[model samples]
Target: MAHRDRISNLPEELLLKILSSLPAKDVAVTMVLSKRWKFLWTLVPRLEYDHSMYQDDVDGSSRFSRFVHSSLLLHEAPFLESLRLKLDHYSCAADIGVWVKTAVKRSVRELDIEINSPSLSTPVLLPWSLYSEGCKRLVTLKLSHTTLVDTSSSSPASFTSLKKLSLVHMKYPSQDLF
Candidate 1:
């Protein structure tokens, strides 16, 4: 009699569903468990990037950027169901814009971004224009510590599908925010 790997024998769909419950980073590391899981992480529809998680590394910022870029480039989800980013001083507005655009392009339905720019006298402005008409599938939006640039003219339909919205310590450039 020989021992069999029951978990490995599980269907790919079942494995993916289980993987989805873990953090994105943990899911990625599962690749080292065996060859069978090498591509499983890429199929996950939910992604989360937190700068604080890599603060101990010397090149954390750059590595974080590379990770995000590569993840977005290699990800093969039909649509991103959720994306959460907790960025700090290391990230720039341009990079944030690019990532947001990429997520929106992938039809991310839920977006949660928290920018901790404590040192900045001026708030980092979020490229809300990227979503003015792009995120038609967005259902929930949560933002913190970032200023929203108003493009009110086209914003009414932007978050049309949005059911839950949370804004914490968010600044609006204009008094009117749609």
Candidate 2:
């Protein structure tokens, strides 16, 4: 008799569940670990990008932009249940908008945007689709170090499936956010 080890033994559903626990960056790295997991990450339902985790984001270089851009490209659409992003620098704002647009089109269940901007003169604008019909499926949202340009046109959005929300250092005028 011969001993055999195969990913098939782990079960497809079980693998997907385990992969879901990892962030988008980790998932991307894990794909190279084994051929079995090449597409395993594709099925994961969560995506997280924290700029703080990157190396030397303080300089506000194009590296941050590339990081955000790469994450969007690596991630699949629609099925993403959560998208947590941290942009600590203004340099990445332009790329952040593009990333948000892609995620919004997918109808993500939760959106966590942390302004990685440490210091800035003027406020940055978030991709203003809150009033658009495309983002109706978005239930939960968090914006830190950011400003909501207009609330009048924005629909009443909440994390329908969202159970908890956290705000770190960003400031907003809305009394409703706690």
Which model scores highest in lDDT? Answer: 1
The CA lDDT of each predicted structure is 0.78, 0.66
Off by over 4 Å in 1: 1-3, 56-61, 118-125, 128-130, 151-157, 174-178
- lDDT, candidate 1, 1-178, per-residue tens: 9987789889988897788777676878888877888887898888888877764457445777777888889889899999898988887677777888899889899989888874444455555644567787999999888877654464454677889999998776655433
Per-residue error for 31 in candidate 2, Å, reads: 1.3
What's the TM-score of every candidate structure?
Answer: 0.82, 0.73
For model 1, the local distance difference test gives 0.78
Worst 10 residues of 2 by lDDT: 153-162
- Count of clashing pairs, candidate 2: 7
Model 2 error, position 14 (Å)? 2.7
